[model samples]
Target: MNLTAESVAEALVVNVDEERIDAAVAIQFKDRMRDLTAGAGGRIILDLGRVIFVDSSGLGAIVSVMKFLAPAHRLELAGLTPNVGRVFHLTRMDSVFPIHADVAAALHGAGHDL
Candidate 1:
């Protein structure tokens, strides 16, 4: 899992550099995300611009992260490749979380004046 993190406006922008987010690496991804937002004080903008696929485990991991964030933090997804986006839509998971076109859009939607 090649991922990078940066602060974008009021959100933590996480760029996933992998082509697929599968069960093999979902746990690690989740852990890293949790660490990235540990002391951060805003929503998380996960930029899945490079991710071309996502399986049920990957989706479940994401949901778990969202659940973990709870009232303390928020999670937003952005730049979902067509295939990955389709999975979310197919499973109706897209409606379970907030999705954005890009980090900037996610930030703006989160009410950050960036």
Candidate 2:
């Protein structure tokens, strides 16, 4: 749950410093995300570059974050490792989220101030 939140352009960039996002950390992840993104505006980008694995619970937690952001805000995914990216693709979550190659690409895609 070593998540670091920063404002990059018009987005809130959350960097997951952990190597795995599994059952053990799913709830913590969700709670932490809620805390970090509370009352936030615009897009929230999750930088999962350091995360090597993500279990079903983890994915569910992520989805919860997306749902929580709802009407006023957005949740985007960036820096997905190969395995994690495969999981999203296989689960078709890739279509549900705005997946970017990396944080920079995400910013560029949104035309945010780099």
Candidate 3:
């Protein structure tokens, strides 16, 4: 549940500083994400570059976060590892989210002048 948030351009970049998001950390992750994103504006870019694994609970938590953000804010994902990306693809969650190859790409895709 090591997540850090910072404002970059027009997006709020949240970096997942953990190798895995599993059952044990799912609740913590969700709670921390809520805390981090409270009152935030614009797109939320979740940077998962360091995350190598994400279990069902982790995915659920992520989806829950998106739901929480609602039409007010968008939750995008960036830097998914091969294994983690497969889980999203196999589950078809990739279509549900805006996935980018990296944080910079995400920003660029969002029309940032970076």
Candidate 4:
């Protein structure tokens, strides 16, 4: 899981460089997210612009990342590909995490209008 994390305005934007997050990489993903977000403050925007697919484990991994940052900060999701977005919808995780249409919207504090 190659991720690029940057601080933009009031949020720390983490861009996932993979197209798929499956069982094989779920744990690694979670661990990496924790490291990337360590000590980072304010809102978190997980830019999933390149993510085309996500499995159950992948979903859980995302939730884990959120929990890891719980109370102190928030995790918001951005740039969901169609198929990847469906996984969140079907599993009802979209309501749990904030979803944005693009990275800009996430950075600008947009809603889940996508």
TM-score of each: 0.89, 0.93, 0.94, 0.96
| lDDT (Cα atoms) of all candidates against the true structure | 0.81, 0.88, 0.90, 0.90
Q: Which model is ahead, 2 or 3, in terms of TM-score?
A: 3
Instruction: Go through the candidates in order and give the C-alpha RMSD of each one to the true structure.
Output: 3.0, 2.9, 2.8, 0.9
For residues 28-58, could you state the per-residue lDDT of candidate 4 as single tens digits? 8998999999999888899999999899999
- After superposition, which runs of candidate 2 have C-alpha atoms over 4 Å from their true positions? 111-114
lDDT of 2 by residue, 70-97 (tens): 8677688998999998888889988888
Ranking by TM-score: 4, 3, 2, 1
Q: What lDDT is obtained when candidate 2 is compared to the true structure?
A: 0.88
Model 1 stretches with alpha carbons more than 4 Å out: 109-114
In candidate 4, residue 62 scores what lDDT?
94
Off by over 4 Å in 4: none
| Candidate 4 positional error at 25, Å | 0.4
Q: In order, how many clashes per candidate?
A: 0, 0, 0, 0
Model 2, TM vs. native = 0.93
**What is the alpha-carbon RMSD of candidate 1 to the true structure?**
3.0
Task: Give the range where candidate 2 is weakest over 10 consecutive residues by summed lDDT.
Answer: 105-114
Q: CA lDDT of 71 in candidate 3?
A: 85
Q: For model 4, what is the alpha-carbon lDDT of residue 100?
A: 87
